[model samples]
Target: MSWVLGNLDVIGGHAGAHLLQALPAIVLAFVLALPVAKLAGRLGVLRGGISTAAALMYAIPSLPLFIVLPIVLGTSIRSMVNVIVALTLYGLALMVPAAIDAFRSVDGDVLRAATAQGYGPVARFWAVELPLAGPVLLAGLRVVVVSTVSLVTVGGVLGVPSLGMLFVDGFQRGITAEILAGIVLTAAIALALDGLLVLAGRALMPWASAGKAPAEPSPAGAPDPAAAAAGGAA
Candidate 1:
């Protein structure tokens, strides 16, 4: 506790850096994933190939990838760019499939109706398809946000500035308070970001909250058709 109190500014700075790394990767991933997913959704032949490639990217061990990314991108190993690029790849790998699934999940009937109403491919996508896919797309965003937050901590292993540094420092000094503080703070940040995404999802899709009203019953003085039919049959 004393350690954390003493290092509050340091911890806050690291957390801010962690957000800086994560937020750009997340935003960029979503933007990139949308077009890829949309194309894959439209072209059946591309779906398997695209998904397999994303899966392969995701399957690579994060630490090794983090190390190799600097070499691949011609950046310094100590650079935050390495961490951002690595995390962005991961975000795209996860988000592409989610976006593809979201687009695929849109109702065929709605799509057909849109087409019948003379909506062109692009117009229908924005007006009909994208809006219908909102819930699932938001679900994917939540997953990406949480995953990115957690993964940013792993960058600390490579001396990248993040809350994960607390773990490294605490372990080196044998200070349990620093370790606990890092874990607690990381969890709190993840939860706060996840909650914000949920609220944003709700705000964007207000219709999702407006559930169907229950069917109304017949008027109290009205004759019961089911009972009348039953009595007639008897």
Candidate 2:
């Protein structure tokens, strides 16, 4: 705790920069993933290609990506941008597939009903599909957030002076406390974000099944005519 207090400046800077780097990727991936997911749902071609491409991005080792970016884009670019681009690319792989899965999990009957009611794509998405997909989106976002946290440390390895840099410094300096502080703090941040996503999903999709109903019929049965008819026939 004392060690963490001692490095408050460094820790805060790392947190701020990492957030800056991560926010853009999250927002960008989500916005772009929407259409891609929808299209993938509608046209089968996109599903394979998107999953493949995102997986390819994930396969690109971060160290190599760090090396390649400077050569292609050249240095003088901000560290934040580099982190954003890499994270965004990484996020696309996870987000696209997750979005597709979420969209697919949506009830087709509801979609057809919406279509019958003359709901357009955007309206239908907002009104019906997106709500139902909230849980899956949260699931994906949880993965993305955790991945971003881990990779920000990787970015620090490239002289990015991120949260990872703090760990690296602590390790190199043989300051066990600082290193421990970094690890604990990072885990806390990840847990906090993940919890928030879970809470938000629960709030947004209250209808999503979290548990089974109480193992009995409603105290006041709503009168099922089908059951009543069967009883009468007997």
Q: What TM-score would every model get versus the actual structure?
A: 0.89, 0.84
Off by over 4 Å in 1: 216-234
Please, what is the whole-model Cα lDDT of each candidate in the order they appear? 0.89, 0.79
lDDT string, candidate 2, 145-207, tens digits: 888766777877677866777788888888888777767767777778778888877787778
Q: Show the colliding residue pairs in model 1.
A: none
Q: How would you encode candidate 1's per-residue C-alpha lDDT over 1-234 as one tens digit per residue?
A: 888889899999999998889898999888999999988977898898898899688888999999998889999887889888988899999999999999989999999999999999999989999999999988998888888888988899899999888899889999999889888888888899999989988898999889996555464756577776888999
lDDT of model 1 at position 49: 88
Flag regions of model 2 displaced more than 4 Å: 75-78, 209-234
Which numbered prediction scores highest in lDDT against the true structure?
1
